[model samples]
Target chain A: MEDDYYSIDSILSENQKIQCTFKVDIPDMGHLDGGHERDIKAQSKIQLPLWLAFILIYSDYVDFAVPTPFSSRVRNALNAEAKSVRLSALVGAGGHWYGFGKIIMRLLDDAQANEMSDLLTKTFRDRLAEVIDQAQHFAALGPAGGGGQSGDSALAFREGLEVTERELFSLAQESAKKTKQWYESTDRLRR
Target chain B: MALPVSLRNSITPPELELVASEELVEIIPLISIERTAFISGAYGPLRPPNKAKLPLWIAMNLKMKKKCHIVPPDWLSVDFLQNRLAQETSRPEFSEFPFRFAEIAKLLLDVASDDIQNSDKVRSLLKDIREARQAKSRDGLQKIDHSELGLPNLCSMEINEIRPFFVRAMGVLTHLTRDPEASSRRLDV
Candidate 1:
């Protein structure tokens, strides 16, 4: 219910690139990688948008490398301190890191897919409490909530959130603000 | 999808309060009136000093118009909220509260604080209980899995607060666990 077919976040996530190694040469497709030679050669690995990579992989023309956002390095960082990792920086704009992983999982064997899934779920669950806390504090603080060092750190944390977590943050903040609105609204009526 | 954030899969706090307003509460009438009838139900034949049961919205309206004294729900009092807050902070599971407790409490306290005994302390106690519950809920969510979660006795407003995050988290879980072979086959078609 949080997403739809027309969701811009999903669209942005699907635009993430995956590394694909060509298994068979295709004529007139060198333009895929700037078209310097006019023909794509066999075994040439190229980074292509996930949607394009899916088509190529399914057609038996290419095999995908695990996208760097879901790489072992990231797995280690997530295992180390999931809360401090900048998920937004991991997958470029919109930062649907989990969404991208799910798409990439469709191209993996079961064992590898499960590992990736577990990593993603773990990262999401681990950072959630922090996300909620930050949202609540910010909502409590209002626009003027930012103050000195803690505010700077909070701002850093906000900028690091991926799209899904950011959405949740805003939703929670909105809930807090609306609840506050009710209090002030009826405050005058109390006499 | 193009709709505003408020229209997302979430029901807002105020909307829940509106729904809570439909719940019946006891009110002491200040003037005589014949029994009245409206869409939700008919009630009254109110004479002076007699307590009558009416929906919270009607009660609030009359309280605002000085026609009745709204009697707060039993759970909305200072001692009860204090007891519940203690249980909330001390226990892992949520303490039992009426399904619409948060909304009902807010509406009552806001509109008729004078009618409620120890309204200021009750209000602060409610805040403490709320913060305690919010912390507990956040802590509980850390163990989120695709399987069943055991958070019993969560009130409507609490559920509303957590619903969006859970829905999306569950969606991702299902997506992650989907059979890859089947997914590729679907892509083939």
Candidate 2:
């Protein structure tokens, strides 16, 4: 569960990076020796986490790779059988599903990647609604009053899991909306 | 399988923490005893028909031994529990109650259902309240509204049932508003 580390802003502040390219050639800080410098040319592709990449990208120091999870593969999977596919498996495929999605959406907005952002938002909203439906269905199956001994206990446990899953979705969605507001407001401030 | 290990551990069922804090019931001693020593203190010299205000644990023990007849707690009355149940169902919110009202009621019902007046009604009402609260919590989880996080009275088992969901939902809301580092920056402003 990425619940603890799901904040997009914190992810950006952390040193993790996604793939990137160097825009400038600079001298090594410590030794100041050309031998140590090993002339790194501009436009050299580099891989870094989203956190580090966001800093460099925001600063115009480097351009980052398009976030991996927002690729054609994920889009196709969602369009093909969005409801049937388990959201946990999708999120599991990429370690930071909520966090990364948020970061990429923000980055796209900054870069004016409207088409990509729109696509991602539609896919995300659709997928999220499906997951909510699944949770509701799971909860509905349990014994309402919980009278029977063995069967009721197991059902109750399942109901708890379903409720928690729904809670996670609500949390993630709420985070997304908050981050969107923060990013939009900050953008306005910058202007 | 997607559930985190930490979450699974967090939901590890709450254990019943029975304490001898209150003199819950009185017991009339049928047999004579020189003295009975407890960690709290030594009680009684010789008694036959002496009513002692004993803690629930000791009273239950004495009652089990057939050496005394137990006087049940005041709230164990069926009318009171039924009123509480009605209040719970009629209102949109739950009110504050004894920490483990459900657990105490269950214990009393199990041990001396016959002893308590209108025991069947009490049992049924408790079950109704438990079910209503559980359903409410489930719906509330889906909404994820902090203002709506009302806790109804719960037994140990019911507490175990809702604790994980409550903690997880609240954790998400707390993390959402602000990151830790961001707060430090705000303090400077």
Candidate 3:
């Protein structure tokens, strides 16, 4: 369920508004407002989904500001958390942790990156440590059982689970691996 | 005493409810035909050596007819499942795995046990984990607090199997969170 929630969160988060400025001049780009059509004029600005923004930005077709969630406000808050509670709260609040991390990591991998890149790296490291710690606590529980029901009662109710939290754990590992790969590739490029 | 209201209400969204429903299965169909008509669309009278991608249901049907060989997913292998079981048993944290892994393995074990090299090992390992989780659930019912409901082994376990445990856990979570006096009484005990 956490996996589904995050997966949905990631998809929804991609649609969050981001400010973008066009560099090239092209005609008939959709209408942005009542009178003004989206002309691909130099220095033209607009708001678009982060997904589209990433593609356009990567292609050098446009430039954009990092959204508020990935800004210092978030980093500062994350830095303040003594445990994973805040990070879990962020996920619980319908935030896409991995999707956001991937975007920031990609930003860090950019050659002409700024101070925000370093901030992202630190935020991710701290957040990940917290997540791992939280997972470790859950891990300590062994598996679901031994509370109210016991012995024969437990065996009587075995039909296999419909969905498991395993996918959530798997997704976390996947995001970690991707982040690691992004770091390694960037390091390789730098050398 | 209890999980916060925000945490308790984070139930499964309908969109992700069918994670394993449409898993594509590879099959080498023995019979050759142009196409078969279904409500959605038409599919090929697939031929041998030319593998067809069909839904698990369709593949199962074809497998039943002896018309095709259902190629099992990579993770369904005996070695991998055994290794996964070992890792899950020994490690505190669960590693990444395919969604519906347990269900898929169970299906494979039922339909094509011979295909797997260590079928016996896989079967026993799964059984052991199942029994352990069931026992844990029985104990979990006694302890109502969220902290006492540790299910690390059930981390990646299938949901339906643990439904009763969660039902009880949720009831306890709701009861304790809504009523501080109840939690205080439990703590006092």
Residue-wise C-alpha lDDT for candidate 1, range A62-111, written one tens digit per residue: 98788788778888988999877899998887688878887887677768
| RMSD (Å) of each candidate, 1 decimal | 2.9, 14.1, 22.4
Which portions of model 1 show Cα errors greater than 4 Å?
A: A1-5, A149-153, A187-191, B1-3, B147-150, B179-189
Candidates in order, TM-scores: namely 0.88, 0.56, 0.37
Clashes of 2: 6
Question: What lDDT score belongs to each candidate, Candidate 1 first?
Answer: 0.79, 0.52, 0.49
Task: Score candidate 1 by TM-score against the native.
Answer: 0.88
Q: lDDT per residue, candidate 3, A61-85, as tens digits?
A: 8877766655666666656752222
User: DockQ of all candidates, in order?
Assistant: 0.45, 0.03, 0.01
- Model 2 over residues B1-189: C-alpha lDDT tens digits? 799643453332212325423435666777877777888776765386777766666656655666776666766677777777787778766644566565456555555565678877776776677667656555555445323454555444445544554555555333322333543463455
Clashes of each: 0, 6, 27
True-contact fraction per candidate equals 0.41, 0.03, 0.00
lDDT of 1: 0.79
In CAPRI terms, model 3 is classed as incorrect
- Candidate 2 lDDT over A41-109, as tens digits, reads 567676666666766777787777665555677667767854443433443322444445545655653
Measure candidate 1: CA RMSD: 2.9
Each model's iRMS: 3.3, 21.0, 22.6
